[model samples]
Target: MQPALFAELRRLYAAADVAGDAVQLPLLDATATARALLIEFPQASDWPSVGATLSYLADELALPRPALSVSAGGAFTLWLAFASPRPLPQLAAFFDGLRVACLSDLPADRLRCHPLSGLATVPVVPAFDAVVERWSAFIDPGMGSMFISEPGLEFPPNSERQAEMLAALRAIDDRQFARVMAQLPTPPQAAMDALPLAGHFTDPAAFLLAVMNDAAVPIGERINAASALLVAGRR
Candidate 1:
């Protein structure tokens, strides 16, 4: 599973499109290749998409920052490792949820989520694309967009830099993953109450829907309701 985390980055390069729409997803129960998770965006048209997506994860989801890799092609990738192997089906859904939620503008067809197996194309490994004769490796995000036009490098990235990038990469623990998984998108339903969210509901949105729409639930109570939604949101 460990080796497959790197392999998944290569897989993202080949299988770059996985989502169908913004609201409802037909997530593939893609089995795992490793103990890691790599959420890639093949539909990222500009460098800002990369920045926005990263910011959403950091600021909104409060997830551990993932390593970013520029592919042999023009697509960008986000790689996250786990302290333990995660079930591929749940992992797939979790990742697809993030893609749909954070990258809301991405069309249904152009998105890619899961990482499958590919030989020797792992990020930071400096694989040579024979067709284009350029290299692929982990890059500093501050300077990542500059490489987006032509992701492959003419020469090998400095080994020490690559080493530093790899070293800086952090893995998600079970508790951290579980907390975020509580917020990932679920299959659409008629009402938020239908979801098995906190205890009875599958959705925290239902709590908001109930409190926000009810006139009897006063303004001060409404403010408290919004604050309470955080606890309701957790699994």
Candidate 2:
């Protein structure tokens, strides 16, 4: 994280005035502090610690639960993402263990988790449910459909998976896919209007190309595409 950015977040959290129960104060303070740090920190491995801290604080404050994710890369460059359902104090303890596993000095090994060579499945817990629910909320329902579900969890996909999904869409029978796409509900006009590219694609090919070729498009547009694919795939 950039020093200036971190400092600014610290200031923002510090400046917030309390207007609730005194018991809420410490938890609120901790949540703000952890959130600020998490937002500022780019390293995915560090997320557990920050998430755990914030979760602990949130619990203490009796605040409505929020979701969290800890994603990392593997030996062959495969990505891994995990989430928790509701914030739990145990996650903080788990974060402590993750911290030890991720040594401070090593960059590549830091926070890295991967699938074992012999293992065909990745491990997951109930917490990931909350993560998926919250993540889905952030995305359009169309995009949210792209999320893949395991026995216990759902997650936003990585770039490679996104590419593969796009490829699959290309391979699908066009008329059938179009019919399916038609059934998908249109997203909010506000979200669609916010982007110049969305709500304007008359053809699936154009939509796919816009998603693949347009690096300059806003992040929200990309998110929309992902969500749209999720919804489109369902059909």
Candidate 3:
């Protein structure tokens, strides 16, 4: 095993910061306060979108850069480390704002942030994907486009290199987090709250329209539906 691989992963993404001796993979719970946040871009062919999103965060939002990783299952993840544990609710809101801001063309269905779900399992890395016969690794962003078509490493990455990339990443600290959250368009809709749109309605507007008209959907949900519809329509 590349020992430094896990060492770097643990340093940045671990749910609980351990001192000097802990060796287990992060034991994460859906509702637990988080020390790291992962925003995964799932479409294998959309490296341009990933690049654009990065530009939006840096050139526009003026936020610190996150370490990038290619996942075992074919996605590019922007992994943000928090210097201290922070609540998930506001982070979820911030992610939603990013989606609505930059990725309106990309369906939210294909994007992911976690461990925001209880049923989900956060695995140990260099996690193997048996189906694809590939492994996950942190990547240099300059070379990220190469992975779009064949995401994930066929073999393990260099341990020292992995450690360097992870080390170079700057964790978002308290002041930065506050400023970023404040920049969020007041009350960005938590897209997780909107995930229940029934499967039959492939069209998002149709789903929201149905939600808006259905008295059974809570009044707040209906309002959110209308708000989403308005936001979506304007774009």
Candidate 4:
């Protein structure tokens, strides 16, 4: 096993917040001269499509075709082992093109890449099982589930506050509800408008629920909405 490659993969797994034992090492090809790159996604629906697209991309770019595998976790592992050493530029270009191809088909936030082995001059036995054992041991179950919650992001609607706001809104008539909504700040107004519910929700609580759950909405707007809800509830 290449120590440097293992270290890099370890770092990437942590940075990407990959779920429990989600990392997969690149498998050695028939000649055992090269190891493949690993790519993972959050969902399984697109894995086969991505694999096909990658194969097409490799042919179009005149790059080495990668051996593709799928994991239960919905990751697509692409292997492109070379029997002989290749130029760094050649490898870099291939990976770059692969990245672009993936981005064109999937959301950028859902993709991750991990380099398992460096360019090799000679065939080396890929330590796939060993790598898996090491990673399985390295993962901490206590760490909890992985998600995209960034630091400093303030999400709206903690259970207690949301309940209070909902209760308050429920007590109001439509005229009063409209008045309270009108008093909401511009940022929350914009956020609410961006939601699919927007003006369509008959209940204020449901509208807030939609705003709270949308990951695409700005955090500030969500917070603003929560605050507005609290203030409106008081009225």
Candidate 5:
């Protein structure tokens, strides 16, 4: 992990009004490189149900239950330190499933699972870390508060929509993928409307490209936009 990102994470933990002692777990081969997962709740009142859910998931996944950290903020971070390198695709799939199952209904809050390997030179680890770092800041409460407060704004797509978006991206049909991207409730009208250059572009390819390249927008939204464009770009 970059020193800056590590410092930011430490700051987040330290700022928590209430927090539990960190629990270190071995995620890969027995080594000094163990990963940590931190679970933070907005208040002590929210801990029981969230704790129970985490416990249930730990039991189901055969992973250790994460210690709870109560705080005034609503975000939770699951930091995984891998002893050995793992394939990015495999890890992404596992974390995606876990996030959907565990965090689908959580309100105005975010759950992020990041995998870090001690060996930074390992293939894909640096790139994956960059992606996580970018998206982590992109989803911060400061950046997302406006969208979260917007009426009818689907800040995070539901399970059904998530599946649909993923399928559209994987599908070979560019037109179908574009249609799905166009209909998504995220990257709200305000975002799209702000893009005057994209106003004349009705095709999904141009619209998605516009969104992806817009630095004013959140990285998560841009990533989704990029995914749609990638699917469309496939010939």
Candidate 6:
């Protein structure tokens, strides 16, 4: 993190409750502050969408803001908003939606497999490497494109980011990885590598179906859903 960005993060944390406008002047030099906010920031009372979060930041900083686009399908989408003009509100909204998504209230049989289509309605935001790893467990490797699309960003979402996420899961138990991957679209090869045989699932398909059917699963499950996708196909 840049010094100016780190200072801005400290300021944001200290003034978390302060309106955006209150701290805008002091944070102008801190471009990395937005990235840090996505990393360690706590979940807010409401999960504002990436666009909404950006709007909030723009309102706070008094900068020109852009419209946020979200997909209706995958967990990866929630982390895509940061590339937009507003990264904060999108992440906030994403967290809120994830809570709702974890409830598994939607009809699994009726749900289509659109990768990020499910998250299309949710918001996106910038996240730190850790947070990305945390969210990747829910993405289906097959479903998630090797690249992410962001408005105004010429470069696609970093492949290294996804690799880092896979590394994080690899550190956990296979059962834990299976449990997490169950809720996602389809697992990728990289994510599938995170699971240990004999981990929570007897078969990857079982894990995926289990998570899709269990709407009552918690946010942790939703976060893990990203990984389940990979396991399912491998089974």
User: Candidate 1's error at 77, in angstroms?
Assistant: 1.0
Question: By TM-score, who's the top model here?
Answer: 3
- List candidate 3 segments past 4 Å from native: 1-3, 17-31, 119-121, 186-235
Decoy 2 TM-score against native: 0.19
What local lDDT does model 2 show for residue 93?
Answer: 27
Best by lDDT: 3
Q: Could you tell me how far off, in angstroms, the CA of residue 62 lies in candidate 5 after the best superposition?
A: 1.1
Writing each residue's lDDT as its tens digit, candidate 4 over 67-123 gives 333332323444344333333333333444444444445654555443322222211
Per-candidate TM-score against the hidden true structure: 0.61, 0.19, 0.72, 0.31, 0.32, 0.23
Q: Residues 35-86, candidate 6, lDDT per residue (tens digit)?
A: 1112111222112333244443345323222212122222222222122222
Q: Which stretches of candidate 4 lie over 4 Å from their true place?
A: 1-35, 62-65, 86-90, 116-235
User: Judged by lDDT against the true structure, how good is candidate 2?
Assistant: 0.30
Question: Residue-wise lDDT of candidate 2 within 118-221, one digit each (tens)?
Answer: 11122221112343352211111132222222121245434343233322211122343234234333334564345445567778856855763343333335
All models, RMSD in angstroms = 13.7, 23.1, 8.7, 23.9, 17.2, 18.2
Q: How well does model 6 score by local distance difference test?
A: 0.30
Model 5: per-residue lDDT, tens digit, 1-235?
3434333333322222212222222233332121232333333334334654555454554443332221212332323332223433334333344444554465423333332212212111111123222211112122223322221112322334322322222111334223323432343456335543425776777777787666444434555665566567675
Tell me model 1's lDDT, rounded to 2 decimals: 0.55
- Clash pairs for candidate 5: 35-81
The residue-by-residue lDDT of candidate 1 on 1-235, one tens digit each, is 1344334333322222322221111122233234555556564365677788788788887877777777667677676666555554456456556655766675534444443211212333446677878776777778777875666688866766665566666667779889888877753334323422233545667766666445333223343454466457675
- Error at 150, model 1, angstroms: 2.9
What digit string (tens of lDDT, one per residue) describes model 3 on residues 131-200?
A: 9889988787788888877878999777677777777777778898888878855433453354454459
Steric collisions counted per model: 10, 10, 0, 1, 1, 53
Question: What's the best-to-worst order under TM-score?
Answer: 3, 1, 5, 4, 6, 2
Clashes of 3: 0
Alpha-carbon local distance difference test for all models: 0.55, 0.30, 0.68, 0.37, 0.35, 0.30
